[model samples]
Target chain A: MLGDQIRTRRELLKDADRRYSLRQVAGRVGIEPAYLSKIERNEVPPPGEETIKKISRDLELDPDVMLAMAGKISSDLQEIIRKRPLLFSKMLRALKEAPDHAILEVVREVTDGDW
Target chain B: MIQLKGTNLVLRFPQVHPKAKASIEFMRTLRVPNDGNTYPLPAGLGSFELEHIEDHKAQLPEDWLKRGGVMLPMFQSEAMWISFNGTYPIALKVATGKINAITGELWTNELTDEPQNYVVLSEQPWLDGYAVEQGTVRQFVATPLGSGESAEEQITGEAAFGGIQIQAFPMKREVYKELFESPKLTDEVQQYLEIPAFLRRCSEPAMGLVPGGSIAQEIHKDEYGLDAWDLSAGSRCFIHTVNSEAWSELTDLPMPHKPISARDYKSANIPWFKYYAQDKKALPGSAILQKLKSKKEKPATKREDAEIGQNMSDLPVVKLRRSDVVTEGVF
Candidate 1:
């Protein structure tokens, strides 16, 4: 699924403007073209976080989205979770089934709330 | 179902497929001069702010509340274009004031092929206005309701509605998997396999879209057949356009400032856009739409050219070529 997302975004970008090639993208992200092709085909697992970040930058994709699809959390997020793992785990589980608008309401409240 | 994310409306069909997602955003742009000359694609300044009618039920009319959709504010004579983004293929029907933008017919719930009434997403990125010709579209310029300038008024002899209506249908699951899930199917094979294919008016001040100057754009024919769309699985929404003054009175939100003039934008050397997809086929112009008179052809309303400056003759345009996936990068 991670591979599909990356490949689809790349193909869309290229389709819109003829901007990049798979090989060119791999080269820019410091990966072998064959390896990148394998990743796109879902023949292999997604690359490491650093490589994904590089790819995201080149493709102009959200790094958080890429990292989430790769099944890895960013270090900063991990640090935040480590601070209060139990509370965060409960919050995450509770918000799992909520709709996007409800989740957005929570985000808005937090953003505007007085600490 | 439609979810308001910021200013964009994200339409998701979970029943159809997990990847069935599409977004619609009304982009603000410079209102091209209707001086009897077609122009290039204008730059997208930003998305218009959208608010749910349910949130402001007390201020809006009963009809709008019953419609239960979103609304945005637009300055008189302001121009807009609809931008679309989809994760997978989607069939979208866009109508302004209950008039089909593609076929120029009264709003219909079903899809037809004799003269396709809808546009397929992922192939068609943005729609500026009515499909007047094979490779040209009239720009959407906002005018006040009851001014006899809206397409709805010109076509149906009434300004009953003054907003946009949209419906989205996702591709069937089996068809999607057959086309996209299999890794063996290349882009070329996918291309080759496919077969060729509003609301009540107002107590509050309202704005309706009218045809402006023509622009070089194409409405791509549906490569997928009619069967590909799951008619059973569809979602529709109504987007009401309110005049800026009434919008502020009702919602208590500040209206967006007027967009830069075409002359000013051209003087700043901002590049206009031109998209080209040689493989895709463009639909022929709609006779009904072609027959309708443009804003320039009719007598100018009192509110038409208050802010519009002199029309510029030439503009700087950037050409966007189709992607070449087959080409390999030189190391």
Candidate 2:
């Protein structure tokens, strides 16, 4: 089931950018090659919400998509709601505080949630 | 940036071919000040600088000898007079010293350690009009853009009548070298000089590239019978980069960060044409429709009048709005 979700996310990313390679994605997420492969293959359940966020950030994937895929919808969504109130608040925060576009990509995940 | 007060005239070449050469020549003429004393300057220059003396009593060089000199018939910095005509009621807080425009004498405690001495005008002064209150009037200051702490805040009040003429008397080259050689003044002047040159250089080409004003777009209509507007891009202006000569010299040493500043070229308040489909049924129809639409073009809008204030020479000598509105407080 974990492998199925990882593959599904990877396919979505592929649709966004056909040329984007796994190593590029891994480098962006700051995860080791073996660890990323293990997670992708379902040898490990989805990494914690932090890791999912880091991956989403590095890959420029919408954070909401990552949260939905990682099954952290209820818990992770609550954490962001508690911290930053206002719709598109995360996007606003990312715009000011994030250092680079990579940081924006990760924060974007939570901002553009399932709704 | 330094604001130079003077009438800026674009010498129209009714039908001159090769625009680039003509433009370059036009810029060169301004450097030739009206004073007969000449330095090593190009014989053939485009632009020239002129000084308006006080009520026909200017200590100018003789007419035949000063043939090369270009004299502006009306006062330079006419914008100040024009803007002053529509200025609001403002209390002028004059600095402790007197600035006699006729003598070019600046007597202030700050000038000399002994609490009194005069310093001659060393920089080109500009008509810097600052708004005392919105929808009322503006006050003019004789701020030599780079010489002041900040260009925006150095404005002094205008005269009761619309006109106040000040001579831009030239200072000695030695004085300029002494005043400007300092690192701070050099840096400020360099930055100040860059803008006018940039404006002159970029105005034609930049306007040519962008259909209306820096935003690229095509016309389209809405679902309703009415023509709906579409904006291709918004909130953008050209900023000179490190590669530009104007920016390059400022970074001769290892700097903390890049000093890149941009001024807003166009805004919503300023009028701009928008694209709209002539027929509402089609998107970007065959006739790429465009309409000149301005939200702030009404008579009451102050900005439209302010723009008209800038082109004062072209405007008819209309009676200033509410002339009594400001003068009542003074009496």
Instruction: For each candidate in turn, give its C-alpha RMSD to the true structure in angstroms.
Output: 21.0, 27.7
lDDT of each: 0.76, 0.27
Q: What is the TM-score of chain A alone in each candidate?
A: 0.79, 0.49
DockQ of each: 0.01, 0.00
Q: In candidate 1, residue B37 scores what lDDT? A: 61
Give me candidate 1's TM-score against the actual structure. Answer: 0.68
Question: How big an interface RMSD has model 1?
Answer: 13.5
Instruction: Tell me the tens digit of each residue's lDDT in model 1 across B38-134.
Output: 6667767668888877777778877676666788899875788888866578899998888999999998788887788899886777888889999
lDDT of 2 by residue, B134-237 (tens): 11112221112222211211223211111122111122233334544567765554432222221111100000000011111211111211111111110110
Model 1 Cα displacement at B196 (Å)? Answer: 25
DockQ of 1: 0.01
Q: What TM-score against the true fold does each predicted structure earn?
A: 0.68, 0.22
Error of 1 at A108 (Å): 14
Candidate chain B TM-scores, in order = 0.87, 0.21
Per residue, candidate 2 scores C-alpha lDDT tens digits across A1-115 of 5446555777677788864456767776778878888887878878887777777666566767777777776465677777767755656565676577555333221010010
